[model samples]
Target: MSDNFSRPQHTAPLTPILQLVNSAPIVLVAFFAIGLSWWFLLIGVIFLVVGGFGYWASWQRRFFWLNEEGELEARSGILFRRSRQLRISRLQSVDILRPPVARLLGYSSLKIEVAGSGDSRVILSYLSVGKAQELRSEILALAKDERTSTQSAEPADHWKWQVPNGRLVASLVLTTSTYFLIIGAVASVAFALVEPGSGLVTLALAVGGSTISLIAGITSLFNFSVGRNDRGIAISHGLFTTAHYTVSPIRIQAICVVQPIAWRPFGWYQVAINVAGADQSSKKSGPRVLIPVVHEDALPELFHELLPSWNLEIEDEWLASAATSRWRFPWQAARLAVSLTSDLFVVRSGALTRRLSAAPHERIQSIRITQGPWERKLGISSLHADSVPGPVRLRGRGLASSVAVHTALAELDRMFTARKSRKSEQW
Candidate 1:
């Protein structure tokens, strides 16, 4: 196969179909408006034709290729040309996504993320399955400074963890949201008996929102699996839109393990990670789920494989919250604890949903000690270790002021030492 990606390449011929499908929602609205006026039907027809033509034009203008400097370059837009360049050195992750429609048509998309680039994700859409896979491998190879053109055989990955379809469905159904949904539903029914008009509206809204949330959760987490390959940790999941993510261990900043009260009986936990360059604010691009659901016993092995460099064990001597902290966090103060290992800083908190957040020493961005008016009166302070935005949050509340200060200084020293050592090692 020719490795001549230097020449600009267009998306698959079927891209217009996918684009049109995406625009169908607008057409649907137009159809609904037809009841208001027959002119709406004519308008809908015109919109569909114009949208289809625009999609074709946009598809024709979009192009991607490798430049002389080895950076991935893309250009798109019809009137105002928009150009993007992705430096291989700053590459964070390369993911393959196949939405329901694209999968049905044997097509896929590549989502390329770069470090330190906010909201600048580059997506190469509507590529043939084979072509997308080949391009993905090529990009990964180039990012690693390996000059190769031929497609390599898939690496033999040792499957580490998998979530059963049954467990996944059950987990989604058993969440706090489900509880709220049930309560709202029952309340709405009661209200309807008292005031029929308002009650019906409340019931409809509650059911509609909860149903959508449940369906989205199920679709996103269905068939979740994690494994280790030659490149890095591989995560695959989704029902309608399957996504395969390749995350390098070095890019991981922090890890969080959460166990909801309801899931405690089953000894199930959910693990999420904070990775560099991932959009933390957006739900659609938040922390990557390392494992949607897993038994507690499997955690040691999972951590060992995912974070080979860090010591995963929690130390027995943990810094507990101050006695006076009960004034602020009555129920949770007893559960608040923080610990530091040779290689990791760990924080534990939460009552109903127990959370364990850990970050490697080198990954800690900053250390802060905070004391509010109430905390000051109670002689308590909070310590926080900042990291890249994600699910893993390193914070220990309700610590003795003296203890918080000492721990913060110690952590700063450890962070510097870890960073210095890391700099000495070659990638």
Candidate 2:
């Protein structure tokens, strides 16, 4: 706690580049809206104003290290100047990000993420690209130096890094699906070529629009990296501009491995850490994404490194195949017989991966049993189990009817609620 070790001196602190990068969206917005109305010019002016203020703020911010004290500090802000200090002992993970423009300029950004240390988020925006690896090694050395002085057993300094294999493919999929700039460019050009008025203006807009999209795509692909080091997990991503996220072990709330249909063929899954301090505005954007997209086999290593308490075996406990109900089967059959007399009815478990699962009583968030008029006449039901992200529904179809659905919901509720009231015990 004394902060006695010698730290490196600041060497021409990196200029803030992320601020410039955040301004790109505003410019793209202006270009795409060129011929809409006078509002387009107004929007451009608004972007200029915001970008100018951001540039001023960037100039005001500076991050550096103190040689004698072995501490890192960053001071920044236009309206509210803020500074954060960190000792080497509390070091967590260090990450590097380079947008295409940053790479072109031979510069890379460094984020020194620390845990146990309060509010010491350091972002160095314009470090020499050539020095990135060397600087990373130097920082780790400083961290090791602190550990040696403590006389306690030093933690292993090795970091587990997960780099995505299909990052470019994923980027393309996202761009083609969500990005509107390409369509905007085409529209702008087509109108410029064929329309009567403002041909030159439309042409300029189309060219500008295309350039931004290409730059954005290149920047996005070059900037994604996830790693778990001494302190915690670090996520750094972006193309022209980048954001750095550091989450401490003690602060982690939940960890979920997500698999989408698109990634199924490659056996790829994404690991997300739900922590209290994370910005959860977007599903893709996180306080950090530890591993962007990697093979399922690699999950164990990543989870063990980042979340020591996590058990991948818990996947076995998720519901897959439905259970057979003796009493309900007859009821369901009778209902299905009557309902299907008019129309066909189907029932099955929602999980694609078949497995045995006993739903934990305490974990249940909500339970509902629904019946439409047709199903009501047949005495059948549909059951839903809701959670934070969404609901998992199990339809009993016609075989068991309402009795089976109600029984399952009641059993699940009892298990979840009872567990909540009991003392700590092994799962």
Candidate 3:
């Protein structure tokens, strides 16, 4: 675990121009929109150039190196002089992003995400695309204990599946956009009905925000794809602003497959995952997407390929035997199901937003069994596989026979104990 290698301290040599290129579109839009005088415009140009130079100067002082303890050490900032270190073992994912300008310049940005809250990580921008990929693979290989002091020119490639362009567009357009559009229409109507004078302004804001959301959703899914190689499952997508995300199987804490009510007719489902110490930090599902739009039949195959440990075959049998307690909420229980395997537990629920969530035995930070007054009478319990804080909780409610409930809980506890022992021994 001890290796020390350092890069010469400097920004990407072309970062200054890259900054200018990044801001060009915004600058041009503002220039024409405001119609400033020639002198004022010239001053603006000078200010931007100076700012870019300052940013490049700051990056020049930044140095990134691997320390003896296998942590990434970053020394940055000009006036502030900030230093940070991220342990290689705690690293979650390495994402590569390429905005159009960066791609045009043959450069890419590396985003290093670790296991925790907040945006505490490293970012090396405007490196050659090849260099970024090399760095990503090299760092990821460390966690698997497969890397050496010597280097390889390219990361190993094992291509899996690329989302079809048609499917991506259909998925985005059919779901969130439609919801936003309906809300915009209703809100606009309500505003007009409530206050005539302010109606136009409110309507304009509602429609505008919805339109922007729709556009952003569509843009985010552009060129979306997923693959697997030696290190782990890799995802790459985006049109104007491209990004690549990779996660090792061991770090995949949970996975969810969702099918919107509208998408059910089409048999389309969107898959999302929660990694050990990472969050998309976006309100939208853009950051967690495993598959944007996939048919029901295709999901098992994809899950098998990307996550072989998660077996979904148990789903059919589980659904048949799913709790049929008449006391269970009629609306929610019918659509709910759960499946179990030696390594993973899957929970399927949701009415309008049908969800199938799964988590590995070791990832279960805690397990809880709860019984309501009605459920206690019915002799049923709700089982929760609790992990780190996330937007969704994975659980199966009103499953029959307290015996079955206790059995599952005991099994989870045993698995959790065994996994912890194995990890402690490895360390």
Model 3, stretches more than 4 Å misplaced? 1-7, 20-35, 45-49, 64-73, 83-91, 113-120, 137-153, 183-207, 279-287, 315-330, 339-341, 369-382, 398-427
Off by over 4 Å in 1: 1-4, 36-41, 116-120, 146-156, 182-207, 280-283, 422-427
Measured against the true structure, the TM-scores of the candidates, in listed sequence, are 0.88, 0.45, 0.77
lDDT against the true structure, per candidate, is: 0.82, 0.51, 0.71
In the range 95-170, model 3's lDDT, one tens digit per residue, is 7878888888789888776666665578877688877766776687664553434433434557678888887887
TM-score of 2: 0.45
**Model 3 lowest lDDT segment of ten:** 1-10
For model 2, how does the per-residue alpha-carbon lDDT over 322-369 read when each residue is reduced to its tens digit?
A: 233323443323222111000111122213321111123344345566
Clashing pairs in 1: none
Worst 10 residues of 1 by lDDT: 146-155
Q: Write the per-residue lDDT of candidate 1 for residues 1-427, one digit (tens) a residue.
A: 2466878989898899798897788777876766556687677778768988998999999999978787789999999999998886677777888988888988999888776646467999989999888887777767666433434445458655778999898887777567768788888889988988677777787778877898898999899888887677888899888878877677789988898888989999988898876666575564378888888887778877776676768765898999999998897999998898988899989998899889989989999999999999999999999999877788999999998999899999999899777652121
Candidate 3 CA-lDDT value:
0.71
